[model samples]
Target: MSKNNSPDSIIRDITREFNTIVDSVSEESNFIHDRYFRFAFADPIRMAELLTLFSRRNASLKAFLDTIDLSSLRGARENHSTDKHIGSADLVFEVDLKNGGTTGLYVGIIAEHKSDKDKLVLNQISEYYHHLFLERKKDVPVIAFIVYNGEKDWNPLTETHFADYPEFYHDIGYPFKAIYLDVGHAIDDSEMKSLSPITLVALTAMKYICAKAQYTAPRSYRQVHLPLRLSA
Candidate 1:
């Protein structure tokens, strides 16, 4: 458990780390974010919190997430053979079926974290989704998510190569839902105090872009901008 629980500082640290790595390192920043994101999200607790928040918008998935055992998040891996590695983490789990009584199987929930620079690789992701179904026998629910954390960028769905020829892959429906969780938008000032300690600390490590100060100061003193999500 980390000592720092402040969301503001955490958010700042995330942006700083990402920007620093991209600016200084020889390697493209994708691998760095992939490793960092995997470690942070692999922690069942943090993953649960965000999923809980996401469940607010979805009813069926909400029910599934309620009893989900975070201990089952296997690990993350990226296929680096391609020139631009569109890294994705693997989250597999199986829970008791709400509909099926005793014969229920363990359902797999594969979540792919899409960062700022990541393009939409529908073919690759779709292929991976199929592999999970065929290669590994698992009841993959409709709850798989493609978490898009990039604020300003192209949409992963329409911007991909598949856009050119929809006729070829019209039958195969995309398995995962595109859930946007961009950190570019700061939390409202009024809602900051009410945030959970875990959420505050975890979100920074989750996904966030470095933003400019939104406020200005008075004449005599220098402008001091407080963090958007104040730690209570």
Candidate 2:
């Protein structure tokens, strides 16, 4: 498919229904800063790459990433259901633990997304965590992976954001936090010669929230780019 920037145009849904649907795609950038984010990281391979990216940035996460049984990943889920009601997660990941004991047996990554500086909902993430726990009736370890695509002054939610102490707080030796993605840094380094092409693609997509307006597939600068331009 040609790279185009018609946010109004309806793109084909690749999975589920596979029938060309309209208005179901993430096009508008108002209510939600990121519309196409789910599409980008929904794949487990891409998700693994993202986690690997995290490991590269934060050394502590490397150990956590190592514990994840990526081969045992069941796949990514969206809008996962609870026993009584529905609570949607931007992306949900299920993976087994590698030689995990006690709380590390089976794990889940509840990836909540953001493009603006929205704080974590009071109990939304925890609620999902509890729901997943009840379903299995086991001590399931879960990670709240918050992928913030906004370039503005954004940070992880503080302990005050929760009604009570989070389950994983003391276990992880910190307030409940997210596996964060700094989108701006990704875009800035996207042009680096040292990075891989796939990394550039991931970086570019990560910037969709911050630079979506200026991001266009430019064959050139303009008709008067001191000597270059892109024409249809």
Kindly list the per-residue Cα lDDT of model 1 for residues 1-232, writing each as its tens digit: 2357465656555444434433322343555655545534544555665566656655655766655554454332322224322433344333444443455444555566655545545555666667756556544553465555444554555544444576776445577544444433433334434455435433543333322223222221112233554444
What is the lDDT of every predicted structure here?
0.47, 0.51
lDDT of 2 by residue, 1-232 (tens): 1155342221222221111111221453422333344555555666776666667666656877787777666544444344212236666778887764556467767777666666544256666666655455645567777667665767655444334666655344322345666655543342333432233343444554355456543232121121111111
What is the lDDT, from 0 to 100, of the residue 211 in candidate 1? 28
Model 2 off-target regions past 4 Å? Answer: 1-35, 76-87, 99-104, 135-138, 158-177, 186-202, 212-232
- Could you report the Cα RMSD, in angstroms, for every candidate shown? 7.4, 8.7
- What is the Cα-based lDDT of residue 163 in candidate 2? 42
Quote the lDDT for 65 in model 2.
77
Among these predictions, the greatest lDDT belongs to 2
